[model samples]
Target: MSAPLRLILFDVDGTLVDSQATIFAAMRAAFSAAGLETPTRPALLSGVGLSLPVLMKMLVPEADERTQDQLVTGYKEAYHDLRLTQGAAHSPLYPGARGLLEQLSETPDVLLGVATGKSKRGLDQLIEAHGLERMFVTRQVADHHPSKPHPSMIDTARSEIGASQGDTVMIGDTSFDMQMAEAAGVAGIGVTWGYHPRDALGSAQHMVEDFAQLAGVLNKFWTVDHE
Candidate 1:
């Protein structure tokens, strides 16, 4: 008999690509364009996994909805322009990222998916740039979901992949990803190389320091018999 299906969901920014430089630059440009004070690096980095609108609100809590919308629009434009100028190489994958994905893709009964705060266009650009268009089976982006820490993205991915919560795992760099996994009743695995600090990822069932250690951590989950 075939092995039970295993759904592995990934988060994009801090989890996959180290887009810190690109993100920070674009955020500064956005605030400058909007005639507002640029947020500190720490403040900006802290909000990495949230949707644009929600992120703007966190950065400038006193701003009205209209101002927040304007900031979000400005940020998107700046980020897109920067991406065009720098190309995909500007955002490098963390060490062992591609190899880990390749290994997971080759595993039997394993399916890969992405649940990211990035927009669909952004996600597609990153995937295509890295020649990973065929890797992920399902792509869930912030364009459709409410935001991170919400279970909607994970729930949708699980449903589309037809994998029970017990057979799925969420791997990411932030507490938002861990919380989302918990809400979906799936295993949450945190990576230390991402944006959020290790202490913030307390919700994760397992935490690995690097991508090389991820396979072993995940193997424990995949080998379990949920039936």
Candidate 2:
């Protein structure tokens, strides 16, 4: 009999790609264009998994909806300019990320998906630039779903990929990801080499310090021990 299919969903920023520098630069440009103060790195990183408007609101709670809208527009413009100028350097994959994805793709029963706060355009750009258009089976973006911790993205990805909650795993680097996984009744695996601190991922079913550990954890998850 064929092995059951399993779904592995990944977050883009702060999880697969180290886009903090670009994200910070874009935020700074956005705030500056809106004549607002730029938030600190830690403050901004804390909201990495949220949608742009939600992130702007959290970062500048005092700002009105109009200001938040302006900031969002400015951020999109600035990030687009940066991507055009820097190309793939705007968002490089984390160390060992590609290798592990390739390994995972080779597994016949494991299907890969993306559940990220990035817009569909942004996600497509990243995937195309990095030659990852063929990597993911289901691409869930902020364009069609609510923000992180809502479980909407995961629920959709699982449904589209035909995977049960018990056979799905969400891998990310933030509490939002873990919370989303819990909300969706899927396993959450936290990676330490990202923006969020390790302690913030308490809800994760497993934690890995690096992609090497991630591979091992994934193996253990799918491998049933027959004692």
Candidate 3:
């Protein structure tokens, strides 16, 4: 709580937004097209942070890399063409989401940014629509860098924000996010409003239930100096 966090990287889908219905619809459609059984939303939701390749593996056990690539491509196409719009048609921003981002933005020393697994195009669309583009200094997404459980995105976020690992915190709804933050040497802040639960955020220094607590935790973890 006394680390003086300077940069806070937030995951989009689960942490900041709730696109579960849309994501499930997309995954259901994707799996159906792939000749696989569509999983229940609860099953697919928990695996949200994994890369497409990994997703394909889960969906189709015998899937090879080439097939995985094709399946992922198909999934993205489907998601882009149909599900994303349907999902964002009615947003799922958790309580106090806007207030917290607004607060973070108002704090000049705070370098607000998006570190998500969504593609840059997808991230841009959501951020622009939500009026968050201006609030965020940078948006690091999937395909632009390696996936979670690898620290590339988190590392890139820190570098883009000119932040030291000691001054950074990665907040997300997935265990992979925790792993990524741990690998990047940053505090992993887990949110219960996201995909995974408290038990999954094993490496997280703190797990918060909502944005009210999120703000307080950030204050405790970060010093006003911005490190």
Q: Indicate which candidate wins on TM-score.
A: 2
Cα-based lDDT at residue 127, candidate 3: 78
Is candidate 1 or 2 superior in TM-score?
2
Instruction: Please give, for residues 2-82, the per-residue lDDT of candidate 3 as tens digits.
Output: 433378888888889887877777777777777767777767877788777776677667767776677787777877876
- Clashing pairs in model 1? none
Model 1, runs deviating above 4 Å: 224-227
lDDT of each: 0.91, 0.93, 0.80
lDDT (Cα, 0-100) at 176 in candidate 2: 95
Residue by residue across 1-227, what tens digits does model 2's lDDT show?
97778999999998899999999999999999999889999999999999998898899999999999999999999999999999989999999999999999998989999999999999999999999888999999999998899999999998887898889999999999999999999999999999899999999989999899999999888785211
Candidate 3 — worst ten consecutive residues by lDDT sum?
A: 83-92
Misplaced by over 4 Å in model 2 are 225-227
Using lDDT, give the best candidate's number.
Answer: 2
Q: Positional deviation of 206 in candidate 1, in angstroms?
A: 0.2
Model 3 gets an lDDT of 0.80
TM-score result, candidate 2: 0.98
- Per-prediction TM-score to the true structure, in the order listed: 0.97, 0.98, 0.90
In model 2, what lDDT does residue 184 have?
97
Which residue pairs in model 3 clash with each other? none
